[model samples]
Target: MKPKKILLMGVSGSGKSLIGSLIAQRLAVPFYDGDDYHPEKNVKKMRQGIPLSDADRQGWLRTLNRLFVNNDEVVIACSALKNEYRETLRQNNEDMIIVFLRGDFDTIWSRHKQRTDHYFNGEDMLKSQFETLVEPTLDEAIFIDITHNAEDVVNAVMRALQN
Candidate 1:
């Protein structure tokens, strides 16, 4: 079945925003970046090289999930780093399809470093992200490599949804 909602998940530099936008445009659905939903406090924390504790994320996760509540035909780009976080996102949604964009540290770190205007800074934040990540199982998501070009990633996601 075609998922009513889709989530692109990964670390800070894993291309969630770029690819999510592409997929949403292709699907002709609304695209929401989870980063945009973060509270100022969370943004300030990450900007200062601080990793959010699960407690710190509770409200954020619930807020993201709320965006999905009673909604579908949408895509969201988020750093759903742990199982609990993913669960939070899935709270009211059974037709949510999550795509995990996996990439090597060096590759993603390089991308993060080259970014000019993003809030996430460098290796320190990247390290915290990886440390927090709990690789999703096949049952939970479709895993794609972030190394793939935008076209390839979008095509893959489309194909995956068709199946």
Candidate 2:
């Protein structure tokens, strides 16, 4: 069966929100951007170009986990940069589908530069995310290259989930 909970994870600017929303729309499920759930303090830090520490993100991660626990089905876009963070998210949602949006620093950095509205757009912040990232293996999650066009990337994820 297809997974009920879907998580799109990667470094900042890896198109998690964009692709996750599309996937959720196609599936007729709710879409949640993990960024929106962050506390104001975290938002302020990121807006000021400060990288958040793990402790700063723990509460936010737990909140997202609670969202997952309460929802029947959802598509969530979160960085999930570290293995421990992903574990926290998986607390009660072991069957969740995780899609790792893979892209190089330069590719994601270029995308980050195009954004003017997001709080997490600094180069240093993006670099820190990459440094913190612990990518999942093939056995752990479906991986999609962000170099592809949006529609194609979504299609790839759909196909991957079917198997």
Give all TM-scores, in the order shown: 0.96, 0.98
Candidate closest to the true structure, highest lDDT: 2
- Tens-digit lDDT track for model 1 on 1-163? 5677998999988999999999989888889999998899988988888888899889988988988875668899999999989999999787799999999899898888789977777688899899889999998999887787888988888888787
Pairs of colliding residues, candidate 1:
none
lDDT of each: 0.88, 0.93
Worst 10 residues of 2 by lDDT: 116-125
Model 1 residue 42 lDDT?
Answer: 87
Root-mean-square deviation of candidate 2: 0.8
Off by over 4 Å in 2: none
Per-residue lDDT of candidate 2, residues 88-132 (tens digit): 999989988899999999999998888988888578888889898
Per-residue error for 62 in candidate 1, Å, reads: 0.7
C-alpha root-mean-square deviation, each candidate? 1.1, 0.8
TM-score of 1: 0.96
Q: How displaced is residue 58 in candidate 1, in Å?
A: 0.9
